[model samples]
Target: MIRLPDSSGRLRAYTPVGKGGHGAGAQGPAPRSRTVFAAAHVVADPLADTTPEGPAAVDWDATLAFRRHLWAHGLGVAEAMDTAQRGMGLDWEGAAELIRRSAAEARAVGGRIACGAGTDHLPATGQPAAGHTLAAITAAYGEQLHTVEETGAQAILMASRALAATARGPEDYEQVYGALLAQAERPVILHWLGPMFDPALAGYWGSQDLDTATDTFLRVVAAHPGRVDGVKVSLLDAGREVALRRRLPEGVRCYTGDDFHYPELIEGDAQGHSDALLGVFDPLAPLAAQAVRQLDAGGAGGFRATLDPTVPLARHLFQEPTRYYKTGVVLLAWLAGHQEHFTMVGGLQSARSLPHLARAYELADGIGLFPDPELAQARMKQLLAVHGVH
Candidate 1:
């Protein structure tokens, strides 16, 4: 039995259910119903001498191995996404290397992969200065786009903080995205990450009003017909996502990035369903893959039965301050034995409170996510003991 701390600072006795042996569900064919990509987390080099402001020290082997694990479970890997700590700790150089390595690995394993292309390389400060012109922002985006396309991997045009700062209005956004789309060699996924995930992006699409922003966003997509494969909506608003998806042009997909209501969104309503490219799938990959397989087998009920129970866990991890959600993701990876340590790039292991992590462990264990319950329990105990929980 382990003692876990709750939000009230009270300790509760808990016994793990030990429901193991669901680890290797990735052997099945890809899901035919929806194209799902798990935005994976990067493993940290725990032994490296690093500081928060310093460059990210990634454990590339472990990171790539985790991608392989995701691919083995029949899920496409969304590389260098926010879940990988882009803009948070991972700089553009690290991200570029990650994209190259992950893309090559995807080729070797015959796994589906898409990489984020953004202007994160530009310095965040003095973004509105003379040096940070729209042309400069466009060039930065073009550079990253070229990196992704050169790897023969699909490009995901990630929402740019630089553009958000530099653009004066909707017209600037249209100009930048229009140029990038026109130059794209293949259809790219466009990501609309809301301000909640990154406060720096409050007025994305050139308006704080979502309806206006949606209009601008759709116009961008409408201007480029076949250049866009899909749009990833991370506004965490299910109704808005449904509405926006319905407005998308023919042959374009709407990939749900809403962790709060993914099951229903992916299961979708009568009109149509959203495909997925979620950060939550990083820790929930196995059960997620299983649920998608159920959906593929025309077992919507079974799919819900498998995935619905996981929503609470997903909501907990992606709770307020959703950007820190990556901390909980890596913690679960450590507990599940996907990575050997609970460390993250930029020493983000301390991002979540001990109680937050304890609850994450409990919820994940309740759903039988750990392949070795005993190992998970032991790790949880060690973590608790380190914090004087004994």
Candidate 2:
């Protein structure tokens, strides 16, 4: 290979004509014609790292930069959610700061953005001595909701682990959510995160049995249809999400967070399709936006063609022990050149093994996710070297 110096004096490897980024160079229009929101994540700051048992040290510059990238692609940014590592490494204080910053940034560029509002600041079992169980959770959620609303961004009422630990049955869910929704400044998006994302939320609606949970969740929405603008279901259960969406009252959008099975869910069956607000989308934003734009063009074949190749890659990243999926997410971002490094809060880059990462890279490359294959390959080499592999 011949190395040529460019204007920047950086060595550029000369390869066979038409063998570089020249092919599938830029993101093309998405094939499927539809509107699917991509929940975006922060680009970790290279300078900051997460303490094992503490809040994350976010790189504000890189963090917001990634959101800007999402807006540039005509996708809405869903911040302060699990995608951003909320409740994982992002504490309420950090989350509030993030919501404010991202919301302001979104305003500057006129970007469509929504953020998560949950009772994460409070303890699971109950609030402090002064804070009542219901009131504490309510107040914590209200604080985040107010923060999000103050920023002029929409609100996503993310499920609460605090509530999960306290609630006795379906009625508790109804009372908590019903009252909260009734007093909302505007209609808010409701979120039902399954155990997959946070196991503590298992049987979230009321019972360990899924059927009971579904009934309870739908009933709450039905009782207060107007206050609920939409529901984000992250169970990774395609059939259940679809079934629940089908029963949703008119005007209530079902934003699917089923990362493992989103392509088909977004595709929709005979009944109707789901709009998206998935975490997998944080890293896959550009590609996802391009795909959705294709669907918007009424290209069912094109949508599948573009996204189908990506499923295996997504599945590999979100494989069992799914909570650590963030590692894969950050890894791909580094490979794709979105982030400066492959490190994450809690040093989660080591969460997955080298073999797991090797497979992820292979799948992502085969699907043409990297705009610059050479960059990706170089980054892969760097990651391997760090692992003490020559």
Candidate 3:
């Protein structure tokens, strides 16, 4: 039995369902029915200056090792993405090193890898002229894009907070993306991170209306079919994602970054299904890969059965203030023994309170995510005791 704090701050004891088994190790080949990438989180150097405003001090070994664990489960690695705390705490220099090291490591093991390219290096202050800002954003994207290609990894064009903060209208977005697409060494995945994830992006694509934003996005993709690969929709709204996916040009894929409604979206309908590049996949990799494998083997029923139970955990971890979801991701990593501690870049371990974390523990355990229940319980007790909960 485990004791947990409910949403109202009351402690409740419940027996954890113990059916969840160990990781489905690299027992088979990768899934073929759908392309999947787990947007991995970085491990912080707990001993470093990991304060809220301090520079990120990463545990490189642990960070890279987590990538290997994802690959071993036959899931591709989406590195240097939001899951890695790209804009939150991980600065451009750190992200560049992460990209280079992860790409080299992927090559060594023949693992699939893709790295984010974004204009996150810009100075945060009063902007220059719109044209100049656009030029600067373009240059920033170009620099990151070249770096990713040089490392021999696919590039995922991350949505730029700089661009969102600078652009005046849809024409600006068209100009920026159009220029970047034309110069790409290969097709790249465009990221559309909704405002919920980053409030700064509330009016992205030059319009607050999602329909207008979708039009602008499609226009950009339609303009450069061969140079564009797909768009990762992180809007969390499954219906909207489906609508957008159906509207995508021929041969362009939709990599679902939606955490709340992934199973249904990935399961898809007769129209089409979403491929995945999800942050939630970091903690749910083993189960996610197993479910995808079931789908590949023509057991859609089995796939649904395997993944359905995990939605509650995913939704809870990705609750409002979704950007802070990395805390829960790292929390699960510690409980499952993927890492040595519950530390995070930017000292984000405190983003969610002890009660919220206790709930995450309960949900993860309910799904049998922890290989050793006793160890998870002990960790929970330790954390609770730290919070003055005896």
Best by TM-score: 1
* TM-score against native, each model: 0.98, 0.89, 0.97
User: Model 1: residues >4 Å from true position, as ranges?
Assistant: 126-131
Location of the lowest summed lDDT over 10 successive residues in candidate 2: 16-25
**After superposition, which runs of candidate 2 have C-alpha atoms over 4 Å from their true positions?**
1-33, 124-132
lDDT of 2 by residue, 1-390 (tens): 323333344444543122233112344432344545667666655575446576677888888888777777777888898878887777888889999999999999888888999988875444323334777677777888888899898999999888887777899889888878886888889998888878878778779999889899889899996888889988888888988999999989898888888889888878899988877887677667766776787787887887777788888888888887888888887877877888777567788877787767766776667767888777877776776555
- Judge candidate 3 at residue 306 and give its lDDT: 87
- Candidate 1 yields a Cα-based lDDT of 0.92
RMSD vs true structure, all candidates? 1.1, 6.2, 1.6
Each model's lDDT: 0.92, 0.78, 0.89
Residue 201 local lDDT, model 1: 85
Q: Assess the local accuracy of residue 168 in candidate 2 as a C-alpha lDDT between 0 and 100.
A: 78
Alpha-carbon error at 118 in model 3, in Å?
0.5
Candidate 2 TM-score to native = 0.89
Candidate 1: 10-residue stretch with minimal lDDT: 21-30
Ranking by lDDT: 1, 3, 2
| Per-residue lDDT over 1-390 for candidate 1, one digit per residue giving the tens place of the 0 to 100 score | 999999988999999888876654546767889999999999999999989899999999999999989998899999999999999899999999999999999999999999999999987676455447899899999999999999999999999988888788999999999999998999999999998899888889999999999999999999989999999999999999999999999989999999999999999989899999999999888888999999998999999999999999999999988899999999999998988988888888889999899999999989888889999999999999889988
The Cα error of candidate 1 at residue 213, in Å, is 0.3
Report the C-alpha displacement of residue 221, candidate 1, in angstroms. 0.7
